[model samples]
Target chain A: MSRYLAAVVLLAGLAHPAVGAAQAAQNATLRRAQQAYDNLEYRQVLTLARAALRERLTGAERARAYELLGFTYGAMDSILKAVDAFKQVVLLDPERQLDPNRVSPKAYSAFDVALRQVLLVRQLRVDSVSFVGGQGAVPVRFTVTQPARVVARAIGSGATVVIDSGAWNGQVNLRWPARLPGGDPVPAGTYTLVVDARLGQNTFSASQPIRVSHGRVDTLPSVTSLPGYQFLPETEIPPQSWRPVGLAFLYTGGALVGTLGLESSSLGSSSKRELGLVGGAALVTGFVMMLRKPAARPAQANILYNHLLRDQIARRNQDIAKENVARRQQVQVTVAPVSPVTPK
Target chain B: MTRAALGPLLLALALRPAAGQLVAVGPQFVLADYREVASGLRYRGNGFGGALWARRNRFSVEAAVVRLSFDPVAGSAADSGFTATQVDAWVAYDVAAYASIEVGVLHRSVDPEFDAQSVGALRVGARSFYQIGPGATVVFRANYLAAPKFSGGGHAAVSLDLGLGLDVRLAGRLHGTATYAFNRMNRRTNPGGTGEIDAPIQETVARLGLALGF
Candidate 1:
């Protein structure tokens, strides 16, 4: 049993050094109380802690004194007295926590009981977010120690905007659109998000500082082309062939045949000089053309396709232009949590 | 027609300021062969002419006038030569990328009033054209002559004209053109109200020219 008691003292010593080192005691009696608790002198710790509570001390030191007494009574197996002392400890510093893994179960149970007996708001958080005005919301969350009437607000220099009000307990979540009653976004400035919880006459409030900023909403750029579709060449060069000469021969032959068939018997035969001159010229031109590079002719299919693609791009750009116009009128709202400052 | 009469007409057509209209005008050197009445009556000649072509959209108009002095060929019955003035005009509408339907008029008048037959006819025709090379095209046409009139007072039941043409763009705003035309008229006539006798006429002409494009 003595060994078990020593182990308990060791665990208690490991758990509390962090809290003791976090804040130095201003009062000599409170410092002695903390040293007696660390040394596992339960009787002396209780006496010094109670005497330190009677002296002039800072709020943190007074809470530490009560916490020392709570641990001493728990070690002495006086559970009821330990719970009472823990209640005083929590009432002074509602946010104080004892690690269950490091502290004796009796002491941790007493601290838990003290927390349930008080009305408090804890772990209030406002996450940083950015969105277009009137389109999104800010997320706020907190924990209530007991069932209470809770009210959340964002108080700025020029305005106090109520975020929410409810009878809530345990973990609570809320979304604040941050807009005015007339549907405009609230003015941009530094704000304090405060959550207050009340149970009968007992009330606790927690606050987080945040900054809201305004900026221009980004606009979309106009499109010059469509994805996966492209313009094609409107003209093409055909391959060189004897088609020109062949066609010339065909036309010349037809004229010759017609002239021979239509000549009158009485008129005998018509002179061939005119036909010879023109047909020879036609044949020579055809041969020369056949040797030359072919002309670029309209590629009908590609021309039609390019026309349609241009129309599509024009239509898409028109839509982007209209969307950018709408975006220009909307505001960008940025809400970021700032480092908290101590409240007076 | 005189050069003075044809000059202003071609000038006016070339100078017309109409949007989307293509116009070309030029002078032509022509070679012609004429045969009439009997095989012994044949003539050959060379002449000069002017031509104008204008097109807007699918419609086009072309006109050519030539004045020729034809002397009888060797061993022909004709003893003298004659001057003939011929005018041809056509208005065409494209029916396909390479084809068009056309209506036109052909009129020819003989000098000295009697050396050769002067004829007038309405032409109904269709032409097919193809682009053979860069700035080069070839055309062929067939026309039926209808309601023909002759200065010698003959009626022809069958008359037809066939043509072949080529145009090549030699340089900017300049083009080389050549055309061949062959026409035949099967005329029947009787002197002093006698029975009809077959008196046929045939002519062939080739025109080559350089044209300015606008």
Candidate 2:
């Protein structure tokens, strides 16, 4: 009888009937915070959840409450503050074992965890790009931990606006095609590109400066003593270009033989008069040279022409003697007679 | 693409001691029509050819070749090769980068219709050469012909076929060609005088053609 009475007294002492009231108060606070959070009233919800947690409330519900507060701050553009709240959630649960269906372990649990790594974008600086290049408007974009819309601008032009799918940072960037719709090329100068973004109510901005160099990609800058052209010696020559050399020599040799034979033949003038044969062995040779299978022989001819052009000029000068003589004769004979040789 | 492309152009630039070259679409195309062999009348014809030359931004050379068949109206199937043949070649100087006048070999049997014939390289872009170069071509060339074989050398006189030619490509690979020629042909007779002639009938030819480069 004594032991039973002692047991009943101990049970009464150990049991605190007011504990249920405390728990009910905590549950009601959480429900209110969640309601405020769903309404996007982040500040109020954060305040409520923080107060409830401070009042000795613990467990997954508290963890979720902290997470909702982080989201609220994040949506409010208080990024650092949001990050801090999420960090606390991680530490509290160590292994991050939170009931996903209820809320989230991390204060900022994103839809895509694969993209959880924080993005710290550095400014894009164009050391130097040629203004004469075919493409314009080089694209430079950045991704951050949250949704953002970036506006890039140059010093003279208004911002080149771009909208990125903020969550995953996926975007379609456009650069000026070889020709712009406006028919004008972007000017060359020290240009500045500025990016402004406002995504999920949070805003961010950055600016990058670049210089537009004036010159052709293949042209050489006149440095003190170097050749005035940049050359990446052609790594490959089409079989059509070099192949003409061999065939040209062969055909040219044959042409030389035919030309010599026809030139030396007794059929020179008489044959020319009777048969109108003025050295016409060029057909076969030309055909052969041309049919040079259309691959490389023409290349040989151009090469030959380029190299021998100087000699050809000299030859042309020599050949012009006949024209000069004809002109002089026409002038002296006709003009002198018509003018009566006035003061000779 | 498809070799179905009408004209193929080759541009050559910068030559080494061995030769280095660059090609632009020079209007040039070669087309051969083989007689169905059953026409009982075999008419084989080859025509349309061109070439463009460059040492890059500095100098250029252009040329073309043309051949047309005369109806074979005068003989049997055996005379198809000898019935009527005309060819021309030429070169031009880039007096200005956009235009050139070529003075080369001209076949008397082709191209002399004067204004009616498109011998100017500028004609290359008109689909005249069936589409040659894609962007730009400038050509200049001259012509010269050799001994012409008339009647397969069967007691037929081998005569001189002289010519002056011109071709130009106003754009990348398109080109127009023309030829003024003095051609002479001799009738043939078998070795035993089956049918022979001592000299050939001489005629002048003026021909015009087109070429395209791919």
Candidate 1 wrong stretches, greater than 4 Å:
A1-120, A143-149, A167-172, A198-202, A213-294, A297-332, A341-344, B1-21, B38-40, B71-81
Interface RMSD of each: 0.9, 14.8
| Model 2 TM-score, 2 decimals | 0.20
Q: Candidate 2 residues B1-214, lDDT tens each?
A: 6554422312321111122334433333332222211233333333444444343443344443445443332332535343222334434444553444444443333222321111111111100111112121211122222333322333323433333333434344444444333333333435466664343233333334454433
lDDT per residue for candidate 2 within A34-92, as digits (tens), equals 66655556678778878777766666566565565565665565666766665555434
What DockQ does each candidate score versus the true complex, computed on alpha carbons?
0.64, 0.01
How much lDDT does each candidate structure score? 0.86, 0.38
RMSD (Cα, Å) for all candidates, in order, is 6.7, 30.2
Model 2 reaches an interface RMSD of: 14.8
| Residue-level lDDT tens digits of model 1 in A1-344 | 99999887665654473355325887888777777767777788878888988889888887778877777788788888888988887777766778777778888888888778878787777889999999999999988889999999999985789999999998999999988778888899999998988899988888989999999999877777789998899999899999989988888888899889888878888878888888887888889989989888899999999999999989998988898898899889999999752321
Looking at candidate 2 chain A, the ten consecutive residues that score lowest on lDDT are A333-342
